[model samples]
Target: MPTLYHAPFSRSTSILALIEELGVADRIDLREVGVARPDGSGGADARNPHPEGKVPYLTHGADHVRERGAIIAYLTDMFPEAGLGRPVGHPQRGAFLSWLFYYQGVMEPVLVLDRAGLEHPILQATFRDRDAVFARLSEALEAGPYLLGAEYSAVDLLLSSPFQWLPDAMPRQPKLQAWIARCAARPALVAVTERERAGLVA
Candidate 1:
Protein backbone atom coordinates (compact mmCIF):
# COMPACT_ATOMS: atom_id res chain seq x y z
CA MET A 1 0.00 0.00 0.00
CA PRO A 2 1.07 3.58 -0.60
CA THR A 3 1.54 5.70 2.47
CA LEU A 4 0.51 9.34 2.36
CA TYR A 5 1.91 11.60 5.06
CA HIS A 6 -0.82 14.16 5.42
CA ALA A 7 -1.80 17.18 7.45
CA PRO A 8 -5.39 18.33 7.92
CA PHE A 9 -5.32 21.88 6.56
CA SER A 10 -2.36 21.86 4.22
CA ARG A 11 -1.75 20.92 0.59
CA SER A 12 -2.27 17.32 1.68
CA THR A 13 -5.95 18.10 1.91
CA SER A 14 -6.06 18.30 -1.87
CA ILE A 15 -4.27 14.97 -2.19
CA LEU A 16 -6.80 13.40 0.15
CA ALA A 17 -9.54 14.68 -2.12
CA LEU A 18 -7.74 13.20 -5.09
CA ILE A 19 -7.51 9.83 -3.38
CA GLU A 20 -11.21 9.93 -2.71
CA GLU A 21 -11.85 10.96 -6.30
CA LEU A 22 -9.78 8.07 -7.53
CA GLY A 23 -11.78 5.74 -5.27
CA VAL A 24 -8.49 4.35 -4.01
CA ALA A 25 -8.89 5.35 -0.42
CA ASP A 26 -8.74 1.76 0.76
CA ARG A 27 -5.57 1.15 -1.20
CA ILE A 28 -3.72 4.04 0.40
CA ASP A 29 -2.38 4.34 3.92
CA LEU A 30 -3.30 7.77 5.19
CA ARG A 31 -0.95 8.81 7.95
CA GLU A 32 -1.77 12.04 9.68
CA VAL A 33 1.21 14.20 10.53
CA GLY A 34 2.03 17.58 12.03
CA VAL A 35 3.03 20.38 9.68
CA ALA A 36 4.19 23.83 10.65
CA ARG A 37 1.27 26.14 10.10
CA PRO A 38 1.15 29.85 9.30
CA ASP A 39 0.22 30.48 12.92
CA GLY A 40 3.29 28.50 14.05
CA SER A 41 1.16 26.10 16.01
CA GLY A 42 2.61 22.74 14.85
CA GLY A 43 5.96 21.07 14.44
CA ALA A 44 7.23 18.48 11.98
CA ASP A 45 6.45 14.80 12.37
CA ALA A 46 9.43 12.50 12.84
CA ARG A 47 7.73 9.80 10.76
CA ASN A 48 7.39 12.04 7.72
CA PRO A 49 9.95 11.07 5.08
CA HIS A 50 9.89 14.36 3.18
CA PRO A 51 13.28 16.03 3.38
CA GLU A 52 11.53 19.30 4.09
CA GLY A 53 9.16 17.51 6.49
CA LYS A 54 6.14 18.61 4.51
CA VAL A 55 2.69 17.10 4.22
CA PRO A 56 1.38 15.24 1.13
CA TYR A 57 4.49 13.12 0.91
CA LEU A 58 3.94 9.64 -0.49
CA THR A 59 5.88 6.43 -0.31
CA HIS A 60 5.12 3.17 -2.07
CA GLY A 61 7.58 0.31 -2.02
CA ALA A 62 10.99 1.75 -2.89
CA ASP A 63 9.55 4.83 -4.57
CA HIS A 64 8.81 8.14 -2.93
CA VAL A 65 6.92 11.09 -4.35
CA ARG A 66 6.81 14.69 -3.10
CA GLU A 67 5.42 17.97 -4.40
CA ARG A 68 1.74 18.33 -5.14
CA GLY A 69 1.87 18.17 -8.93
CA ALA A 70 4.24 15.21 -9.05
CA ILE A 71 2.14 13.24 -6.60
CA ILE A 72 -1.03 13.92 -8.56
CA ALA A 73 0.62 12.89 -11.79
CA TYR A 74 2.05 9.74 -10.24
CA LEU A 75 -1.20 8.54 -8.73
CA THR A 76 -3.33 9.40 -11.74
CA ASP A 77 -0.97 7.60 -14.04
CA MET A 78 -0.68 4.71 -11.68
CA PHE A 79 -4.44 4.20 -11.66
CA PRO A 80 -5.43 5.18 -15.16
CA GLU A 81 -8.76 3.39 -14.77
CA ALA A 82 -9.84 6.36 -12.70
CA GLY A 83 -9.64 8.44 -15.89
CA LEU A 84 -8.39 11.49 -14.02
CA GLY A 85 -5.23 11.56 -16.09
CA ARG A 86 -4.53 12.03 -19.77
CA PRO A 87 -2.32 9.11 -20.65
CA VAL A 88 0.78 9.29 -22.85
CA GLY A 89 -0.85 8.54 -26.21
CA HIS A 90 -3.88 10.70 -25.59
CA PRO A 91 -4.13 13.95 -27.57
CA GLN A 92 -4.63 16.01 -24.47
CA ARG A 93 -1.60 14.54 -22.71
CA GLY A 94 0.58 17.52 -23.50
CA ALA A 95 -2.03 19.93 -22.25
CA PHE A 96 -2.54 17.89 -19.12
CA LEU A 97 1.16 17.83 -18.26
CA SER A 98 1.47 21.50 -19.10
CA TRP A 99 -1.31 22.45 -16.69
CA LEU A 100 0.19 20.35 -13.92
CA PHE A 101 3.64 21.84 -14.36
CA TYR A 102 2.27 25.34 -14.78
CA TYR A 103 0.53 25.13 -11.41
CA GLN A 104 3.78 24.07 -9.78
CA GLY A 105 6.19 26.21 -11.80
CA VAL A 106 4.19 29.41 -12.19
CA MET A 107 0.75 29.75 -10.62
CA GLU A 108 1.68 28.75 -7.07
CA PRO A 109 4.78 30.94 -6.73
CA VAL A 110 3.12 33.98 -8.23
CA LEU A 111 0.04 33.62 -6.05
CA VAL A 112 2.11 33.15 -2.90
CA LEU A 113 4.23 36.18 -3.70
CA ASP A 114 1.19 38.28 -4.51
CA ARG A 115 -0.50 37.19 -1.31
CA ALA A 116 2.57 38.12 0.70
CA GLY A 117 2.65 41.57 -0.91
CA LEU A 118 6.16 40.84 -2.14
CA GLU A 119 7.37 42.56 -5.26
CA HIS A 120 10.62 42.13 -7.10
CA PRO A 121 11.85 42.54 -10.65
CA ILE A 122 13.18 38.99 -10.60
CA LEU A 123 9.82 37.50 -9.66
CA GLN A 124 8.02 39.57 -12.25
CA ALA A 125 10.51 38.48 -14.86
CA THR A 126 10.32 34.83 -13.87
CA PHE A 127 6.65 34.12 -13.10
CA ARG A 128 4.94 37.42 -13.84
CA ASP A 129 2.13 38.28 -11.39
CA ARG A 130 -1.27 37.01 -10.29
CA ASP A 131 -2.83 38.95 -13.15
CA ALA A 132 -0.90 36.95 -15.71
CA VAL A 133 -1.73 33.73 -13.93
CA PHE A 134 -5.44 34.54 -13.73
CA ALA A 135 -5.41 35.68 -17.33
CA ARG A 136 -4.00 32.35 -18.40
CA LEU A 137 -6.63 30.52 -16.39
CA SER A 138 -9.40 32.69 -17.78
CA GLU A 139 -8.22 32.10 -21.33
CA ALA A 140 -8.23 28.33 -20.88
CA LEU A 141 -11.53 28.31 -19.02
CA GLU A 142 -13.12 30.34 -21.80
CA ALA A 143 -12.41 27.51 -24.22
CA GLY A 144 -14.51 25.08 -22.17
CA PRO A 145 -16.03 24.54 -18.76
CA TYR A 146 -12.93 22.94 -17.36
CA LEU A 147 -9.18 23.42 -17.80
CA LEU A 148 -8.84 20.49 -20.20
CA GLY A 149 -11.88 20.98 -22.35
CA ALA A 150 -15.19 19.64 -20.97
CA GLU A 151 -13.69 16.93 -18.80
CA TYR A 152 -12.91 17.63 -15.16
CA SER A 153 -9.41 16.34 -14.48
CA ALA A 154 -6.74 16.63 -11.83
CA VAL A 155 -5.67 19.96 -13.22
CA ASP A 156 -9.08 21.43 -12.57
CA LEU A 157 -8.94 20.25 -8.98
CA LEU A 158 -5.43 21.66 -8.63
CA LEU A 159 -5.77 25.06 -10.32
CA SER A 160 -9.09 25.79 -8.65
CA SER A 161 -7.76 24.88 -5.18
CA PRO A 162 -6.00 28.05 -4.12
CA PHE A 163 -9.08 30.12 -4.74
CA GLN A 164 -11.10 27.77 -2.53
CA TRP A 165 -8.60 28.20 0.28
CA LEU A 166 -8.66 31.97 -0.02
CA PRO A 167 -11.93 33.05 -1.55
CA ASP A 168 -10.95 36.71 -1.27
CA ALA A 169 -8.01 35.97 -3.54
CA MET A 170 -10.33 34.58 -6.20
CA PRO A 171 -11.08 36.85 -9.11
CA ARG A 172 -14.58 38.12 -9.75
CA GLN A 173 -14.73 36.67 -13.27
CA PRO A 174 -17.89 34.64 -13.69
CA LYS A 175 -16.33 31.78 -15.61
CA LEU A 176 -13.50 31.43 -13.14
CA GLN A 177 -15.83 31.61 -10.18
CA ALA A 178 -18.10 29.07 -11.78
CA TRP A 179 -15.24 26.67 -12.41
CA ILE A 180 -14.12 26.96 -8.81
CA ALA A 181 -17.66 26.33 -7.64
CA ARG A 182 -17.91 23.24 -9.80
CA CYS A 183 -14.71 21.85 -8.37
CA ALA A 184 -15.77 22.71 -4.83
CA ALA A 185 -19.03 20.84 -5.29
CA ARG A 186 -17.36 17.51 -5.96
CA PRO A 187 -18.43 14.80 -3.50
CA ALA A 188 -14.79 13.85 -3.06
CA LEU A 189 -13.97 17.31 -1.77
CA VAL A 190 -16.98 17.27 0.51
CA ALA A 191 -15.97 13.91 1.92
CA VAL A 192 -12.47 15.11 2.67
CA THR A 193 -13.78 18.25 4.35
CA GLU A 194 -16.20 16.30 6.49
CA ARG A 195 -13.53 13.80 7.51
CA GLU A 196 -11.19 16.57 8.53
CA ARG A 197 -13.87 18.39 10.48
CA ALA A 198 -14.75 15.18 12.32
CA GLY A 199 -11.08 14.61 13.11
CA LEU A 200 -11.23 11.28 11.32
CA VAL A 201 -8.01 11.88 9.39
CA ALA A 202 -6.57 15.05 10.93
Candidate 2:
Protein backbone atom coordinates (compact mmCIF):
# COMPACT_ATOMS: atom_id res chain seq x y z
CA MET A 1 0.00 0.00 0.00
CA PRO A 2 1.14 3.55 -0.63
CA THR A 3 1.52 5.90 2.32
CA LEU A 4 0.54 9.54 1.86
CA TYR A 5 2.32 11.98 4.16
CA HIS A 6 0.26 15.12 4.30
CA ALA A 7 -0.48 18.32 6.19
CA PRO A 8 -3.89 19.82 6.70
CA PHE A 9 -4.83 23.18 5.10
CA SER A 10 -1.86 22.91 2.78
CA ARG A 11 -1.15 21.54 -0.66
CA SER A 12 -1.95 18.10 0.68
CA THR A 13 -5.62 18.95 0.47
CA SER A 14 -5.27 19.08 -3.29
CA ILE A 15 -3.65 15.63 -3.38
CA LEU A 16 -6.33 14.23 -1.14
CA ALA A 17 -8.97 15.60 -3.48
CA LEU A 18 -7.15 14.01 -6.40
CA ILE A 19 -7.17 10.65 -4.67
CA GLU A 20 -10.87 10.89 -3.99
CA GLU A 21 -11.57 12.17 -7.48
CA LEU A 22 -9.63 9.28 -8.96
CA GLY A 23 -11.53 6.80 -6.78
CA VAL A 24 -8.29 5.56 -5.19
CA ALA A 25 -8.74 7.08 -1.80
CA ASP A 26 -9.28 3.71 -0.18
CA ARG A 27 -6.12 2.18 -1.61
CA ILE A 28 -3.65 4.53 0.08
CA ASP A 29 -2.82 5.17 3.69
CA LEU A 30 -3.18 8.80 4.68
CA ARG A 31 -0.65 10.09 7.23
CA GLU A 32 -0.92 13.58 8.63
CA VAL A 33 2.20 15.68 9.19
CA GLY A 34 2.11 18.66 11.50
CA VAL A 35 3.43 21.93 10.17
CA ALA A 36 5.84 24.30 11.85
CA ARG A 37 4.43 27.22 13.79
CA PRO A 38 4.95 30.82 12.82
CA ASP A 39 8.11 30.70 14.93
CA GLY A 40 9.46 27.92 12.66
CA SER A 41 9.35 25.08 15.14
CA GLY A 42 7.94 21.63 14.38
CA GLY A 43 9.01 18.03 14.59
CA ALA A 44 10.03 16.01 11.59
CA ASP A 45 7.29 14.05 9.89
CA ALA A 46 6.82 13.86 6.15
CA ARG A 47 9.40 16.59 5.79
CA ASN A 48 11.99 13.89 6.38
CA PRO A 49 11.13 12.49 2.97
CA HIS A 50 12.01 15.66 1.09
CA PRO A 51 14.79 18.23 1.42
CA GLU A 52 12.28 20.98 0.90
CA GLY A 53 10.49 19.91 4.10
CA LYS A 54 7.12 20.03 2.43
CA VAL A 55 4.10 17.86 3.05
CA PRO A 56 2.12 15.69 0.57
CA TYR A 57 4.86 13.07 0.20
CA LEU A 58 3.99 9.58 -0.92
CA THR A 59 5.87 6.32 -0.47
CA HIS A 60 4.96 3.09 -2.17
CA GLY A 61 7.20 0.07 -1.72
CA ALA A 62 10.66 1.46 -2.58
CA ASP A 63 9.43 4.45 -4.58
CA HIS A 64 8.96 7.88 -2.97
CA VAL A 65 7.25 10.83 -4.63
CA ARG A 66 7.07 14.46 -3.50
CA GLU A 67 5.75 17.75 -4.84
CA ARG A 68 2.10 18.24 -5.78
CA GLY A 69 2.40 17.76 -9.56
CA ALA A 70 4.70 14.76 -9.25
CA ILE A 71 2.40 13.18 -6.66
CA ILE A 72 -0.66 13.46 -8.92
CA ALA A 73 1.21 12.05 -11.91
CA TYR A 74 2.60 9.19 -9.86
CA LEU A 75 -0.73 8.26 -8.29
CA THR A 76 -2.61 8.45 -11.60
CA ASP A 77 -0.03 6.19 -13.21
CA MET A 78 0.26 3.82 -10.30
CA PHE A 79 -3.47 3.23 -10.15
CA PRO A 80 -4.62 2.88 -13.71
CA GLU A 81 -8.01 1.66 -12.55
CA ALA A 82 -8.85 5.21 -11.49
CA GLY A 83 -8.75 6.46 -15.06
CA LEU A 84 -7.80 9.93 -13.91
CA GLY A 85 -5.19 10.42 -16.59
CA ARG A 86 -4.95 10.19 -20.33
CA PRO A 87 -3.37 6.93 -21.41
CA VAL A 88 -0.04 6.87 -23.19
CA GLY A 89 -0.21 7.43 -26.97
CA HIS A 90 -3.60 9.07 -26.57
CA PRO A 91 -3.79 12.46 -28.29
CA GLN A 92 -4.88 14.17 -25.10
CA ARG A 93 -1.94 12.75 -23.17
CA GLY A 94 0.44 15.41 -24.39
CA ALA A 95 -1.97 18.23 -23.67
CA PHE A 96 -2.80 16.69 -20.29
CA LEU A 97 0.81 16.56 -19.26
CA SER A 98 1.38 20.04 -20.58
CA TRP A 99 -1.28 21.54 -18.31
CA LEU A 100 -0.26 19.37 -15.39
CA PHE A 101 3.32 20.58 -15.61
CA TYR A 102 2.27 24.11 -16.45
CA TYR A 103 0.52 24.47 -13.09
CA GLN A 104 3.66 23.58 -11.21
CA GLY A 105 6.22 25.12 -13.54
CA VAL A 106 4.45 28.38 -14.33
CA MET A 107 1.36 29.15 -12.23
CA GLU A 108 2.74 28.12 -8.87
CA PRO A 109 5.86 30.25 -9.06
CA VAL A 110 3.95 33.25 -10.34
CA LEU A 111 1.54 33.07 -7.40
CA VAL A 112 4.40 32.63 -4.99
CA LEU A 113 6.18 35.63 -6.39
CA ASP A 114 3.02 37.68 -6.15
CA ARG A 115 2.32 36.65 -2.57
CA ALA A 116 5.94 37.20 -1.53
CA GLY A 117 6.08 40.58 -3.21
CA LEU A 118 9.30 39.55 -4.94
CA GLU A 119 10.48 41.24 -8.10
CA HIS A 120 12.54 39.71 -10.85
CA PRO A 121 14.69 41.48 -13.43
CA ILE A 122 12.70 42.14 -16.61
CA LEU A 123 14.62 39.59 -18.67
CA GLN A 124 14.98 36.88 -16.00
CA ALA A 125 11.55 35.67 -14.90
CA THR A 126 10.60 32.37 -16.46
CA PHE A 127 6.97 33.33 -17.03
CA ARG A 128 8.35 36.60 -18.44
CA ASP A 129 5.78 38.67 -16.60
CA ARG A 130 3.38 37.62 -13.83
CA ASP A 131 0.51 39.56 -15.35
CA ALA A 132 0.96 37.78 -18.65
CA VAL A 133 0.75 34.39 -16.98
CA PHE A 134 -2.48 35.38 -15.21
CA ALA A 135 -3.90 36.80 -18.39
CA ARG A 136 -3.20 33.61 -20.32
CA LEU A 137 -4.70 31.38 -17.62
CA SER A 138 -7.76 33.60 -17.36
CA GLU A 139 -8.28 33.48 -21.10
CA ALA A 140 -7.71 29.74 -21.33
CA LEU A 141 -10.22 29.13 -18.56
CA GLU A 142 -12.65 31.66 -20.04
CA ALA A 143 -13.74 29.02 -22.51
CA GLY A 144 -15.58 27.44 -19.57
CA PRO A 145 -15.87 23.99 -17.79
CA TYR A 146 -12.36 22.64 -17.52
CA LEU A 147 -8.78 23.25 -18.60
CA LEU A 148 -9.15 20.71 -21.42
CA GLY A 149 -12.40 21.69 -23.04
CA ALA A 150 -15.26 19.66 -21.50
CA GLU A 151 -13.35 16.94 -19.67
CA TYR A 152 -12.04 17.17 -16.14
CA SER A 153 -8.90 15.29 -15.21
CA ALA A 154 -6.10 15.31 -12.67
CA VAL A 155 -4.86 18.45 -14.33
CA ASP A 156 -8.01 20.28 -13.18
CA LEU A 157 -7.29 19.23 -9.62
CA LEU A 158 -3.79 20.61 -9.99
CA LEU A 159 -4.96 23.88 -11.53
CA SER A 160 -7.92 24.45 -9.23
CA SER A 161 -5.95 24.63 -5.99
CA PRO A 162 -4.06 27.82 -6.83
CA PHE A 163 -7.09 29.48 -8.38
CA GLN A 164 -9.27 28.59 -5.41
CA TRP A 165 -6.78 30.05 -3.00
CA LEU A 166 -5.99 33.31 -4.74
CA PRO A 167 -9.16 34.36 -6.47
CA ASP A 168 -8.68 38.09 -6.15
CA ALA A 169 -5.00 37.85 -6.91
CA MET A 170 -5.77 37.36 -10.57
CA PRO A 171 -7.80 39.48 -12.92
CA ARG A 172 -11.58 39.09 -12.93
CA GLN A 173 -11.74 36.33 -15.46
CA PRO A 174 -15.35 35.14 -15.73
CA LYS A 175 -14.59 31.81 -17.30
CA LEU A 176 -12.03 30.98 -14.69
CA GLN A 177 -14.54 31.81 -11.97
CA ALA A 178 -17.10 29.48 -13.54
CA TRP A 179 -14.53 26.73 -13.84
CA ILE A 180 -13.64 27.09 -10.19
CA ALA A 181 -17.30 26.70 -9.28
CA ARG A 182 -17.54 23.56 -11.36
CA CYS A 183 -14.48 22.06 -9.73
CA ALA A 184 -15.75 22.91 -6.26
CA ALA A 185 -19.05 21.18 -6.90
CA ARG A 186 -17.46 17.73 -7.14
CA PRO A 187 -18.71 15.52 -4.28
CA ALA A 188 -15.28 14.01 -3.74
CA LEU A 189 -13.68 17.42 -3.52
CA VAL A 190 -16.31 18.60 -1.10
CA ALA A 191 -15.77 15.60 1.15
CA VAL A 192 -12.04 16.03 1.15
CA THR A 193 -12.32 19.74 1.92
CA GLU A 194 -14.66 19.04 4.81
CA ARG A 195 -12.38 16.38 6.24
CA GLU A 196 -9.35 18.57 5.80
CA ARG A 197 -11.08 21.49 7.41
CA ALA A 198 -11.93 19.37 10.44
CA GLY A 199 -8.36 18.11 10.59
CA LEU A 200 -6.98 21.65 10.46
CA VAL A 201 -9.18 22.76 13.31
CA ALA A 202 -8.32 19.76 15.43
Candidate 3:
Protein backbone atom coordinates (compact mmCIF):
# COMPACT_ATOMS: atom_id res chain seq x y z
CA MET A 1 0.00 0.00 0.00
CA PRO A 2 1.08 3.59 -0.59
CA THR A 3 2.25 5.29 2.59
CA LEU A 4 1.96 9.04 3.01
CA TYR A 5 4.32 10.82 5.44
CA HIS A 6 1.82 13.32 6.69
CA ALA A 7 1.66 16.35 8.98
CA PRO A 8 -1.61 17.72 10.25
CA PHE A 9 -2.86 20.82 8.37
CA SER A 10 0.05 20.91 5.96
CA ARG A 11 0.38 20.10 2.26
CA SER A 12 -0.31 16.46 3.07
CA THR A 13 -3.85 17.52 3.82
CA SER A 14 -4.19 18.35 0.14
CA ILE A 15 -3.15 14.81 -0.77
CA LEU A 16 -5.57 13.42 1.78
CA ALA A 17 -8.27 15.37 0.01
CA LEU A 18 -7.10 14.02 -3.32
CA ILE A 19 -7.25 10.48 -2.04
CA GLU A 20 -10.80 11.16 -0.95
CA GLU A 21 -11.55 12.60 -4.38
CA LEU A 22 -10.15 9.45 -5.96
CA GLY A 23 -12.14 7.28 -3.54
CA VAL A 24 -8.99 5.40 -2.48
CA ALA A 25 -8.63 6.61 1.11
CA ASP A 26 -8.84 3.11 2.55
CA ARG A 27 -6.15 1.81 0.17
CA ILE A 28 -3.44 4.08 1.53
CA ASP A 29 -1.61 4.50 4.83
CA LEU A 30 -1.00 7.84 6.51
CA ARG A 31 1.83 8.43 8.96
CA GLU A 32 2.00 11.61 10.98
CA VAL A 33 5.37 13.40 11.11
CA GLY A 34 6.81 16.64 12.46
CA VAL A 35 8.23 19.67 10.64
CA ALA A 36 11.40 19.42 8.62
CA ARG A 37 14.42 21.46 9.62
CA PRO A 38 14.03 25.10 8.55
CA ASP A 39 17.10 24.71 6.39
CA GLY A 40 16.95 21.89 3.82
CA SER A 41 20.18 20.36 5.16
CA GLY A 42 18.38 17.36 6.74
CA GLY A 43 15.13 15.47 7.18
CA ALA A 44 12.64 16.14 9.98
CA ASP A 45 12.37 12.39 10.49
CA ALA A 46 15.44 10.34 9.66
CA ARG A 47 13.17 7.43 8.72
CA ASN A 48 11.51 9.48 6.02
CA PRO A 49 12.93 8.37 2.66
CA HIS A 50 12.61 11.81 1.13
CA PRO A 51 16.05 13.41 0.96
CA GLU A 52 14.88 16.45 2.89
CA GLY A 53 12.60 14.54 5.31
CA LYS A 54 9.45 16.50 4.61
CA VAL A 55 6.01 15.94 6.07
CA PRO A 56 4.25 15.88 2.68
CA TYR A 57 6.37 13.25 0.95
CA LEU A 58 5.22 9.71 0.21
CA THR A 59 6.46 6.19 -0.48
CA HIS A 60 4.33 4.22 -2.89
CA GLY A 61 5.82 0.77 -3.05
CA ALA A 62 9.39 1.52 -4.23
CA ASP A 63 8.56 4.92 -5.65
CA HIS A 64 9.39 7.76 -3.28
CA VAL A 65 7.46 10.84 -4.35
CA ARG A 66 8.49 14.16 -2.84
CA GLU A 67 6.92 17.59 -3.33
CA ARG A 68 3.17 18.08 -3.25
CA GLY A 69 2.95 19.05 -6.93
CA ALA A 70 4.66 15.86 -8.08
CA ILE A 71 2.53 13.81 -5.68
CA ILE A 72 -0.61 15.34 -7.14
CA ALA A 73 0.47 14.51 -10.68
CA TYR A 74 1.52 10.99 -9.73
CA LEU A 75 -1.69 10.22 -7.86
CA THR A 76 -3.92 11.63 -10.59
CA ASP A 77 -2.09 9.60 -13.21
CA MET A 78 -2.10 6.45 -11.11
CA PHE A 79 -5.84 6.77 -10.65
CA PRO A 80 -6.87 8.15 -14.02
CA GLU A 81 -10.44 7.01 -13.70
CA ALA A 82 -11.01 9.77 -11.25
CA GLY A 83 -10.69 12.10 -14.26
CA LEU A 84 -8.66 14.59 -12.23
CA GLY A 85 -5.79 14.55 -14.69
CA ARG A 86 -5.53 15.52 -18.31
CA PRO A 87 -3.55 12.72 -19.95
CA VAL A 88 -1.43 13.17 -23.11
CA GLY A 89 -4.21 12.55 -25.56
CA HIS A 90 -6.59 14.96 -23.96
CA PRO A 91 -7.01 18.36 -25.61
CA GLN A 92 -6.18 20.25 -22.43
CA ARG A 93 -3.28 18.01 -21.47
CA GLY A 94 -0.68 20.68 -22.18
CA ALA A 95 -2.48 23.12 -19.95
CA PHE A 96 -2.79 20.40 -17.33
CA LEU A 97 0.93 19.72 -17.13
CA SER A 98 1.66 23.43 -17.17
CA TRP A 99 -0.47 24.11 -14.14
CA LEU A 100 1.15 21.34 -12.09
CA PHE A 101 4.65 22.45 -12.94
CA TYR A 102 3.72 26.09 -12.46
CA TYR A 103 2.55 25.45 -8.91
CA GLN A 104 5.92 24.02 -7.91
CA GLY A 105 8.29 25.76 -10.28
CA VAL A 106 6.94 29.25 -9.81
CA MET A 107 4.11 29.62 -7.34
CA GLU A 108 5.78 27.77 -4.49
CA PRO A 109 8.99 29.74 -4.51
CA VAL A 110 7.30 33.07 -5.08
CA LEU A 111 4.75 32.53 -2.35
CA VAL A 112 7.37 31.47 0.17
CA LEU A 113 9.61 34.39 -0.62
CA ASP A 114 6.71 36.80 -0.61
CA ARG A 115 5.47 35.54 2.74
CA ALA A 116 8.90 35.70 4.38
CA GLY A 117 9.95 38.97 2.75
CA LEU A 118 13.01 37.36 1.28
CA GLU A 119 14.31 37.44 -2.27
CA HIS A 120 17.07 35.99 -4.41
CA PRO A 121 18.38 36.89 -7.84
CA ILE A 122 17.70 33.38 -9.13
CA LEU A 123 14.10 33.41 -7.95
CA GLN A 124 13.64 36.84 -9.43
CA ALA A 125 15.13 35.72 -12.71
CA THR A 126 13.09 32.55 -12.95
CA PHE A 127 9.67 33.58 -11.61
CA ARG A 128 9.87 37.33 -12.25
CA ASP A 129 7.84 38.38 -9.17
CA ARG A 130 4.88 37.42 -7.04
CA ASP A 131 2.76 39.87 -8.99
CA ALA A 132 3.45 37.91 -12.16
CA VAL A 133 2.50 34.70 -10.44
CA PHE A 134 -0.68 36.20 -9.06
CA ALA A 135 -1.47 37.80 -12.39
CA ARG A 136 -1.24 34.45 -14.14
CA LEU A 137 -3.37 32.83 -11.49
CA SER A 138 -5.90 35.63 -11.66
CA GLU A 139 -6.06 35.28 -15.44
CA ALA A 140 -6.58 31.54 -15.28
CA LEU A 141 -9.12 31.83 -12.50
CA GLU A 142 -11.01 34.43 -14.48
CA ALA A 143 -12.12 31.53 -16.68
CA GLY A 144 -13.42 29.72 -13.63
CA PRO A 145 -15.07 28.24 -11.59
CA TYR A 146 -12.23 25.73 -11.99
CA LEU A 147 -8.60 25.97 -13.16
CA LEU A 148 -9.25 23.95 -16.30
CA GLY A 149 -12.71 25.18 -17.04
CA ALA A 150 -15.58 23.31 -15.29
CA GLU A 151 -14.01 19.90 -14.57
CA TYR A 152 -12.94 20.73 -10.99
CA SER A 153 -9.60 18.97 -11.45
CA ALA A 154 -6.94 18.20 -8.83
CA VAL A 155 -5.37 21.50 -9.85
CA ASP A 156 -8.14 23.20 -7.95
CA LEU A 157 -7.22 21.49 -4.71
CA LEU A 158 -3.48 21.97 -5.17
CA LEU A 159 -3.56 25.61 -6.24
CA SER A 160 -6.34 26.85 -4.02
CA SER A 161 -4.45 25.43 -1.02
CA PRO A 162 -2.25 28.40 -0.12
CA PHE A 163 -5.30 30.59 0.22
CA GLN A 164 -6.81 28.08 2.61
CA TRP A 165 -3.73 28.02 4.80
CA LEU A 166 -3.50 31.81 5.01
CA PRO A 167 -6.97 33.07 4.45
CA ASP A 168 -5.96 36.72 4.54
CA ALA A 169 -3.46 36.10 1.79
CA MET A 170 -6.22 35.79 -0.74
CA PRO A 171 -6.63 38.97 -2.71
CA ARG A 172 -9.77 41.04 -2.52
CA GLN A 173 -10.81 39.90 -5.98
CA PRO A 174 -14.32 38.49 -6.00
CA LYS A 175 -13.48 36.00 -8.75
CA LEU A 176 -10.55 34.54 -6.83
CA GLN A 177 -12.57 34.33 -3.62
CA ALA A 178 -15.40 32.57 -5.46
CA TRP A 179 -13.03 29.97 -6.89
CA ILE A 180 -11.59 29.39 -3.42
CA ALA A 181 -15.11 28.94 -2.06
CA ARG A 182 -15.76 26.22 -4.62
CA CYS A 183 -12.57 24.49 -3.53
CA ALA A 184 -13.41 24.74 0.17
CA ALA A 185 -16.95 23.51 -0.38
CA ARG A 186 -15.74 20.41 -2.22
CA PRO A 187 -17.06 17.30 -0.45
CA ALA A 188 -13.68 15.60 -0.69
CA LEU A 189 -11.93 18.54 0.97
CA VAL A 190 -14.54 18.77 3.72
CA ALA A 191 -14.30 15.04 4.38
CA VAL A 192 -10.49 15.00 4.56
CA THR A 193 -10.41 17.95 6.97
CA GLU A 194 -12.74 16.12 9.36
CA ARG A 195 -10.85 12.83 9.07
CA GLU A 196 -7.42 14.42 9.52
CA ARG A 197 -8.63 16.46 12.50
CA ALA A 198 -9.99 13.33 14.14
CA GLY A 199 -6.78 11.45 13.40
CA LEU A 200 -4.74 14.25 14.93
CA VAL A 201 -6.81 14.20 18.11
CA ALA A 202 -6.53 10.44 18.40
lDDT of 3 by residue, 1-202 (tens): 8888777777778988888899987777877777654454334676566676566887887888888878888888888999998766889888988898899888877888888888888879987787787777789876767889877998888888998878857867787788888899999888878876687411
lDDT for residue 122 in candidate 3, whole number 0-100: 82
Candidates in descending TM-score order: 1, 3, 2
For candidate 2, the TM-score is 0.86
Q: Which ten residues in a row have the lowest lDDT in candidate 3?
A: 35-44
1 or 2, greater by lDDT: 1
- Count of residue pairs whose backbone atoms collide, per candidate: 0, 0, 0
lDDT of 1: 0.91
Which tens-of-lDDT digit does each residue in 1-202 have in candidate 1?
Answer: 8999999978889999999999999999988889889998998789888999898899999999999999999999988999899988999999999999999999999988988999999999999898888889999987789999888999999988898789879887888889999999999998899988888892
Scanning candidate 1 in windows of ten residues, the lowest lDDT window is 193-202
The lDDT values for all models are: 0.91, 0.75, 0.80
How far out, in Å, is residue 1 in model 3?
2.5
Model 1 TM-score relative to the real fold: 0.97
Better of 2 and 3 by TM-score: 3
Worst lDDT 10-window in candidate 2: 122-131
- The residue pairs in collision within model 2 are none
lDDT leaderboard ranking:
1, 3, 2
Better of 1 and 3 by lDDT: 1
